[model samples]
Target chain A: MACETDKALLQENIEEYIKDDNKVVTCKWLSLMHSIDINVAKRALHIFVHHQRNKGGNDDINVTFFVAGLGKSKDGDLMHKCAVVPETELEVVKRSLATVTSCHIFSVQKAKLKDYTPLYMTDYEVIKDNIDKCNRFSSIKCPWVSLKSGLSASKSAQQDVVKVVLSENKGHAFSNKTETGNDSPGSKTRALAKKVEPKGSITSMFASASKKDGGGNESSKPVQKTDAASKIKATKKKGGVTAFFEKKGDSPLKQKDVLLGKDSKKMDASSERFESNVTNEKKQDPKRKKKQAADADEEAPDKKRRRRIKTDLFDSSDDEDVEAGEPEEPEEEIEEMEQFEVLDKGIEEEHKMTEEEQKEEVDDSSLTKSAVVGKKRKRTKKVVSKHYEDEEGFMVTKKETVWESETDEEDEASVNKQEKKSHQSNTSEDMGKLATKNTKAKADPKGKAAAKKNSSPQKSKQTSLMSFFKKK
Target chain B: MFEARLVQGSLWKKLLDSIKDLLNEAIFDCSSTGITLQAMDSSHVSLVSISMNSDGFDTYRCDRNLSMGIHLPSLSKIMKCAGNDDIITMKATDDADTVSLVFESPNNEKVSDYEMKLIDLDTEHLGIPETEYSCVVKMPSAEFQRICRDLSQLGDSVVIACTKEGVKFSASGELGTGNIKLCQSASTDKEEESVVVDMNEAVCLTFALRYLNFFAKATPLSTQVQLSMSKDVPLVVEYKISELGFLRFYLAPKIEDNDGDN
Candidate 1:
């Protein structure tokens, strides 16, 4: 049964929805169902009930009761059914209300008589049982039920894990039910085991699902959930609530996860699965390697790519000639590449890390801000990419290097975090140098890459190998 | 001091009525020889020159050269006090700030005086070089005014063409094109109805119809109007002030883009 506040919210939402198009609200149920937009459906539902009562010539009937009658549809023998709402009508209203609220309607609730789980239940019971007051629901101080999260952790987790599976099967809708059924048991157990780490892993899973959906070419099997979770964990640190449900889902468990113990375990399993999947993915499709490399190039700090390209250009000039398809001008290209390399080494330091590891490292560096609360914020665990530090200045310099160009969008938040850390006896000079390096890298890509790669261990290895061959 | 008295005040009234629409104020230079007013319309695309000799006035006197700036609308309003046959006397002391117009009825039944405020106007006086026009047309003033009024409905500008055979006033707009051609009249006894074009070469020029209609307001002042045209020069529409000189209107021809011709 709907609470007084829920009824008021419904009335206000319907009013706002119908205020624009009063004609559409008067539309018949059959035609109303055909409306693709939910606002139209909600408004049409209001008008349907309005007209229904008007047909009975009940001008004297309370508008509140008439509005409450919105949950009752006149279908077949169900006409004039006692004002107690039907489940199907609630489902219809919820569908339309989802559009009105700019969110999905997961569940509708009345004020419960007792205390429940503290995880995901938003307080919707503050409407103060006065339907006839015509009070605006907007003015009423009811904490909104976030549609992204479940009513309770256990209940919403099962639903969202199923949603995660369902979203995974969206591309292949024919096998959706079977795939969802298969994962229902495993995800249920994983959901319980991942209670503390739900936001991080679930959000990461959503990000990977969205990434999968973006790729569209890949036929996703249910087995890829662990891999998806890992990739999401990698990408979702900077991308908060990228997945639809994850935004609301993040709100729950946000307050309750004091224990970091279970979250670290979940991250390890997901990261291991991610690393395994990367190898298999690299092997199955050589084309995908180039794409992943490009994706890495896109995701990698501009400073790092500049460094990598710089090293790739200089140490192995012959290798680049073969790679870039400019055999006719090899001498000139190598000369140009050398000149570019000399200028680049004056600025950026090169480092060698796989693109995936670099992305993980970037995410981890961003997470360094929240590292104090490791257990509670599962999002902080995404900082998995830690480079081997030979010196404090050299290794820690990567965060400033990562601050270069492409990551500037996400870097703003990360910059705030870095600023707080930099205020306490950290190298402020390196921060300024890195800031200038970012601007320079933005100006001259060729110079930035060559300069950036100067610090790469990979470049040193390649150069040493070349010298060995030359000595031979 | 400057004083000029004319027998028929209605003539100045008609001239003022026609030019008042184009010019707000004008400097009337009163010399020992005559009174000459030279001014451009507000847009500077058209110029009006009124030259009246001292011989045309019943009495004329100028103590020294005086250029009096007069608002045309106010002059038109003062002229309204005079009957068609009233004697009009315009008087101003040396460096007078205001000009006085005295009107006396023909039968001495009524007399009225009007004093109008004068303003200092900085006006550029263009020396119009005299040129032998390629075409000169003499047509009935009312007929010319009628043609301008009718054709202005067709477009913003009227293209006047003078050939050996005839003179044509043509206009084209969104509604359609209209052309009124009056061939050289062969000895029409009624001279006012005749079209006489003396042409050395064929001449065609486009002048804004709005100004042409505004120039047509002088229809009440004269029986005939003379139009003179030459290539790349301003077209002149002159109404001769009988026993005086002339009230001539000079309009710059429209520069038609060659792109349209090509």
Candidate 2:
């Protein structure tokens, strides 16, 4: 694709080119016209003319493609997931897809270097979507010489600097040959797997796995496990299970409503009346169970007390100690609780959640649904955020996703949740075990006061809990 | 690679700071060989964690695993001895009480190593945790610092009164009271700091001359400071360091009438 028209003539169609409103491409098209990867133009034409069934537009495919993709993409935002700053070492090519789209060139200095304009946002999706069409590039006015003059890359990576003729994915620095070679029709649609990635790496295998097994499929669990195992093996040489996450976010939102959190457009705020209703559920349920509990209270109230305290990680440790299951059993549990507090302090300081806070989630399904009501608009936060990840850690500000991700912070949260929950139910399941211990202290009415004296130091327990939850 | 759980005393920093009984040092317990000490400075409120774990080292050798107990004075001295470009090397042998710190500069020109022995200091510190407050406002730290800096120009004593609306930092001299409202804030061409505030909670507390004078230290660390208050609760100064941690200061709010309205 080369400039056949004057710069003045093409300036007339700048508004039309900018109409697509893709934040990344709109910014990069200007750079491509003057200094695009010669292969980028050639490949884009190959895809648009051949794969997209616009084959006859070889005349216009060269012109309008860059304008539609890069021109419009930059106009919105130069959202780049992450940039490969000059000093990235040990970053794996097999697992990582290193894409440098027309968008990531935030500010391309012209021949003068002083005057510049913003370029395309080079995230995987934005580039993948618009670059498939080439007729769009025909509209742009290339101030630089034609494609024949631009194919200057000695190696593919140099395409970042040189303006290449054919806009192919070749020399694109990202994508293995086979992956990039799929500009074919059936293959083009088949390869949309890189759009939404799980496991956080920009790898082809992981990306394809996410595409095949995403959207709350129970099958995703195994895929996730396999991906996680592979990732752990890849990341930690000679690795065992380095990380495990038990994701139990607020019990408030129902499973269906939880899915709505990802579907930003589907959120309905009018249903928030359910939040106040759930908060009242506990009080209401007690009333419903009042008569049954009142009769049971006459005889130890054992079942009610056990049922009520079963879910609490803290209370279970106390119960285990009195049972004499082991002499020094509670010490380990106490230590785990203590470590939890330090973790909480760190998360609280960062405005995130410790696993402890997540573990105590009591049917938060209603609370989340209420939180996501009319307040929920059709926002593409994840998409925009993906663009900027190249600068910051690709942080998605979808509050719900972030809140959910918080539970799996280091997989420690999930481990503690299981350790605490199962320990609580251990004593209640077998009273025969507690009854076997015969070392009963001499019975005295003063036992209550003595217990209080011994437990005075344990008051730090509350503070520990606060530190764990980062109680404000 | 190694996560050592230290089951020690729980002393809440926020609670302890209320009565001026906060610990002088941060005692981080870590087992030797497979561990990480990733700390971001409290001054830069946005978090930057510095993590160097067992895997991070190419050749990590530890004969025995021991719990780490670092004191404040030792840390300060080490920071003073180390230069910016110095490669810091810490080595402690098995059963060794002291860890050696060596600084190797460029080209075998100079290398310095020093060992500081571990001292037994009581970890438990008594702190008064109770305090009541009047008001609290979470404002951007940049704006708060600007107000403090701008008002400090008028006089040394800045009477910071708060309302449900916003915080007012006013100082008077022979001229008049210099007031600044950080609530409804804007930026000019020269300045580019704008924050959308959800500041429904507000507090009006008057700080003493020297207190606001010294508070000049906190603003640079964080972008936002949540100023918490109660009539009796010491005013809480909170700032978030990006993603790392929060550094907070709790000051006893001075009621002017208590000192005969001086």
Candidate 3:
């Protein structure tokens, strides 16, 4: 492959090329034209330049050398510099640089070259023509340049395909796990086991053994285990089971509704119509029912006592009328009977009072009834008068007249029998009164009282101070 | 082996002081032409680029292309030990883990050498293209630094508006609003002190005063600071390091969510 004649011919061609004093010739351009190595071209150029200098042609020929070395930067840091300088200034340029790494004849020209741009352009044209084979004869080697070839490109494509397939499989498995885990813990564990069976055969072997022991028992045991595990996990959380119960306890109205259903049925048969009316109202406005149910639950005991006293007042008034008609008593006794009727009207008027005021009136009426029953001979008439402004801004006066009967020993037992009969009749009248009065008072001060009650309890139900700190 | 000697040693100290607060560690790429460093701040809101040509050095030599990762604060500390007139020399091997710095007193009575460990840093070189800005303003660096420092007292951000008449910097905050304007001066004998505005169009942009204040630390490096601005592009603040090279800062403008207030 080494030919001496071919080298001589390349030398002859270079000699002919340099014969023109106006043209500049570079090693890269010489190497490309002759199809030779760059280092050989550089040596050829050096030998030709020396031959010209030896022939006393130095004054006509000009040579440029490529120098690369380190030089001091402005900020005291060392920097590398590479330059092409003419032969006349080579020594001066070399001294300016701290060190010279490489220095050789880059190009030879007859005319003194002021700009190196034409030389670079000439070399760039040759390099551009043979770009694919340009680095074949060069000494420097870069690994990445070779790695960007056809074989590595195919290899990288295969790796990308493998990565995409792996990512898709991972995504599919992730989506499957989330979908199966949404419904229940027992099903979630089973789904996980099913997914892991392909990856780990040991788990599947255990599952098969458990299935063979008892087919149905296998499912039941895991369900119970998961239930216990979830319970334990819930307790391990910050709020624990108490938080779970507190959430349910927040709505006490639901619990009262359940209790009220049973209590109203067992306690009083007279209030059955009243309870039905309340249920109808609850169905009409569900939002207001919570407040009303809370009010009814709190006032349930007081309301029962007030109902019983109203019945007693009606019964005593009926007995007084019977005695007044049969005995033809004096004017005072007739006046006492009239007062008994007025007291019954007063008991009816008590319904319009606020809950606290109604509670006080119920206590007073019960006390008077019991005291009058104990002292039958001392017939006294007590008149109770109350004045208050109604919702319509009108001052209404309520007069309660309490009359005691002068009863003989024999008449007392018969009076009790007639009183029991009147008790039955008064309950029917009481039901009619509650149906009319409660329906009308739905938008009155009763609603305001329910709102005030609702707000007070909500203010008291603040989060516990301990909840602010995390449990260890 | 590589070595570089500089007579003005205090220039290195000032360069370190200007960039130490912005960059904790940076990679210096040394090539045949010069040494250049480009790095973004930790928040990625601003970038600093430094370039110094080898022609500017008194004596420089490098055998191969090398990249050295250096901690700026430690380098600053080493620089502080040298006198302002001391001659500084930097030396390193081709494949070395540490760089050596030698400080020689001008009178040759004292000399001290320090070795600093080099770190391996993963760096991505961002390509900043050459753009034609709408406005370019040249003014005394001290005046620019003073304006930045004063505006920072009023607001977190300063709005820079450049018009045909003058360049204005305004800042509004809880305390109050402050405005400073610099009109282009006529030709003067003292060129460095004169303000010059070369504008093709008007541009108004907002920038964080905190970062502008940090960039102002380079005021001692040069007499004049050059500012280039365009709509939606980062503002470029450049300070020429004498006849050596330039240190430039690229600051991303603040995006206004409510454009009604300008």
Estimate, for each residue in A1-472, the C-alpha lDDT of model 2 and write its tens digit: 3443533333333323433332223323442443444344344333323432343432221122221121112223222333322111213321232343432212211112211123222322333333222223333333442222111211121222222222223323233444454344433332333332322222332234333322111122223333221221122221112111111211112333344554322222211111223222222223213433443333331212211222344544443344332223343344333322222211121122222433432112222333444333111111111111212334222111111111122212221211211222333423332222111321112243445423322111101111211212
The digit string of per-residue lDDT tens for model 1 on A127-204 reads 111111112222222344232311122223333445667654553453344346554444434333344233333233
Interface DockQ of each model: 0.01, 0.02, 0.01
Q: Model 3: per-residue lDDT, tens digit, B1-262?
A: 7787888888888899999999999998877677789887887778889998877667888789889999889998999999999999888899999999999999989999999999999877777777899999999999999999998877677889999888999987656778999998847689898889999999988888889999999999999999999987788999998867999998888766442233
DockQ of 2: 0.02
Q: Model 2, retained fraction of real contacts?
A: 0.00
Stretches > 4 Å off in candidate 3: A1-472, B258-262
Q: Which wins on lDDT, candidate 1 or candidate 2?
A: 1
Q: Write the candidate numbers in order of decreasing lDDT.
A: 3, 1, 2
The global C-alpha lDDT for each of the candidates, from Candidate 1 onward, is: 0.53, 0.35, 0.62
Backbone clashes in model 3, listed as residue pairs: A70-B60, A70-B61, A70-B62, A71-B60, A71-B61, A72-B59, A72-B60, A80-B32
TM-score of chain B of 2: 0.53
Model 1's interface RMSD:
39.0
Q: For model 1, what is the alpha-carbon lDDT of residue A347?
A: 24
lDDT of 3 by residue, A144-175 (tens): 44423432332243343445456446645664
Candidate 1 ranges beyond 4 A from true positions: A1-472
Lowest summed lDDT across 10 adjacent residues in model 3 chain A is found at A415-424
